[model samples]
Target: MSILNPLFEAVAWVIMRIHAWLSVPFGASSGWAWGLSIVILVMLMRLVMVPLFVKQVRSQRKMQAHMPQLQELRKRYKGDKQRLNEETMKFYKENGINPLGGCLPLVAQLPVFWALFNVLRAISDWQPGTTPKYGLTIPVVQSAKDARIFGASLADKFLFPLPHQTLESRLVILAFVLVSAATTYLTMRQSQKRGMMQQGPVDPDNPAANMQKYMMYIAPFFALSGLYWQFGLVIYWVTTNVWTLGQQH
Candidate 1:
């Protein structure tokens, strides 16, 4: 097994235990309890990473504000790739801006995303006959045969007419996915616009800036594809994205 498998399993175990505890306290089959659990998890993760997010945003703003200086540096160091890199590093150091600061939140979230995926997979694939070889020993496994959240099973139908889909369930999933995609796209667009507005004007001749602009549009499409995977993940992502949107505002 890969090194990450253990970590994934541990997260899954924790999620399961938490779910069990919440179920007991709040009563099983309470959709609110389950939903609240996911929200709480996302909030906790976001709160922990808030410092990183703040640093990233500050660094991005600094970079945007210093674009002119960076451009001048680039022009001065033309034909010297190594020197350009060194100069860029020096600039970041002098300005107290870590070039990698922006990446910290994304990097930190990778494991949480995997953990959520594992937890959702466990919930969707719950069955009684499966031998408990792993650390996932929840006593409610026998009683928790159904993975229905508000009468909708976690199973999804990617095709049209959505087989075995109830009207309410379908609507909930659709709304969740649409909100997820829209919020993600809007948050990214707002961030880009804020950055660009800070930078004054983008250089038409700069391919790098143009490519970054293109990526800002393309990323949401890739992010929205997660709806095809599982609604649980979509819910988690949308919840987090909505939180981010609120925080940014």
Candidate 2:
């Protein structure tokens, strides 16, 4: 089995459970049921990461507060790359500072993100003679395939064509891409605003601070990849981003 099989199974189990719970009211094949399952999954994952998120925010504050020391280290060892690396790590260890801790929430969510992507990809590729992965029954898989959100098939992608997808599907997927990208930008902006408010003006010399600024300008463009991503995965992206905005707000 692939390394991600476990994650796929876990994520798939959650989606199946949510879908089954919603199936009664929304019907077994309702797109809203399936779509909401993905959205809710994102929400659940974020909820579970609350502690990590809080730690990330707190870590950022700590890192910001130590910018002067970090800058001094950088200057002190400007010509010794190896020594700088060693000292930076030593300093972090001494201070209980994990420079990478701020990345925990996003990094933690990556496996689930890719697993959900592959799960939807598997569903999209499922065929009459093919066996389903993730312990999904044929009927359940069929119902999932039939589920539509905003007139777009969850399995469809903007890059897919012709007999495989409808114009409406393309439109809905494009809308999702745009919305995802927009939410991504807003989320970053909101976080930047909060950071500035909490920490005062950003220090340009701080590597972490610089990285944050760079991502604000670059990360939203990644949402455009939704053009090639499954509609269901795009839903996850949009929901996660929207959650970030609301959570940050």
Best by the TM-score measure: 2
For 63-170, candidate 1 gives per-residue lDDT tens digits of 777788888888898789899899989998898777687788878987988776765566556666775423566454433334566665544423342456777776
Number of backbone collisions per candidate: 0, 0
Worst 10 residues of 1 by lDDT: 153-162
Lowest lDDT 10-mer window, candidate 2? Answer: 156-165
Give candidate 2's TM-score: 0.91
Screening candidate 2 with a backbone cut-off below 3 angstroms (N, C-alpha, C), the clashing residue pairs are none
Question: Candidate 2: which stretches are off by over 4 Å?
Answer: 78-80, 204-207
- Candidate 2's residue-wise lDDT over 164-242, tens digit each? 6889999999998999989988888888888788777877666666888888889889999999988898999999888
